[model samples]
Target: MTTSLTIAVKRIHDAAAASDGARFLVDRLWPRGVSREKAALAAWLKPLSPSDALRKRYHGETADSDEAWDAFRLDYFEELDAGGEEAKAALFTLDAAAKVGPVTLLYAAKSAERNNALALREWLERRTR
Candidate 1:
């Protein structure tokens, strides 16, 4: 049977609410100044995050141009497609939780528009369709 998933993206620094449901931190590294207790995460799915090289490359970019964003997303999707067992396990776990109820993907990026969590949510949404 197929299950519908409610995937929402939010900043890790923001206050968590009951509506957030099962919160998963999608950043590979923990957000600065946010304690584990404050994060209130059900799990930190680092394996689902972009590779260090890709992240660093994107960060080095001078501007958040559409071209850069597109490249980042394409590279990120490729990484997800070629990911190994750990990544697969993380995605499986995420899918399981999302199947049961709403899920919020938390990220620490300052830009709400161009973050890995957003890319990941888009990726997941596409696959579910």
Candidate 2:
């Protein structure tokens, strides 16, 4: 397996041409306004997403506030660290995929920087090092 992995984040609704590498959906919920054919997903790894309670508390109205966002990131990081078996499995699968090529984490979040996919990517990069 590759010691380092090349990971990228993309919106599920982005142009199909932007699709690259082994595509995986890291969102717990399917994106609205996007068809399955358009998604062209290889897998939907909901186990990698934040817990339902965490997600609900931080998203929608709360997700718009910087303070909430910061808190969300902090809480989400804790969740990732304590994410246990499912998170480990997701990371393992991602690492394995990267051995062959790049791995693109597909998410529906409007904020590319604040989304779970970014957190997951950051977490994986840190672990691989």
Candidate 3:
């Protein structure tokens, strides 16, 4: 399977429109002001978001690094390793079906540079590679 990650809002809409496409919102909290219908998401994979403690610790912090990921793996097992695995599997099923376009992973965060989406995208890309 081939997949890529992007952060543009318009790109997300475009990806979701393509054939074999699915959009998963990987955030614990729903983005403010966006309705479910308006979001047009196939799934809200909140279980894939970082834990509250981790979010508080890592958000806006540049100190978060590879070691942070290791710490997260231990603490994030229940949410990510277990629940997220299932969500990711489902997304991959969508990917397999989507032979034409990219599967967009969306997020509702103000910080575009440092958010769960980037981390999750990094993790998934590394694994897929």
lDDT of each: 0.90, 0.80, 0.59
Candidate 3 overall Cα lDDT vs. reference? 0.59
Instruction: Kindly give the stretch of ten consecutive residues in candidate 2 with the minimal lDDT sum.
Output: 15-24
Cα lDDT of model 3 by residue, 24-108, tens digit: 7777777777767766777776667776777766554443476665555455544555554666775565456345455666776
Q: What local lDDT does model 2 show for residue 65?
A: 77
Better of 1 and 3 by TM-score: 1
TM-score of 3: 0.61
Model 2, 24-85: lDDT tens digits are 99999989999988888767888888788988888755676789877877787788888788
Give the best candidate by lDDT: 1
Better of 1 and 3 by lDDT: 1
Q: Any idea what lDDT model 1 has?
A: 0.90
In terms of TM-score, the best-performing candidate is: 1
Clashes of each: 0, 0, 1
Where model 1 places Cα greater than 4 Å from the true spot, the runs are 1-3
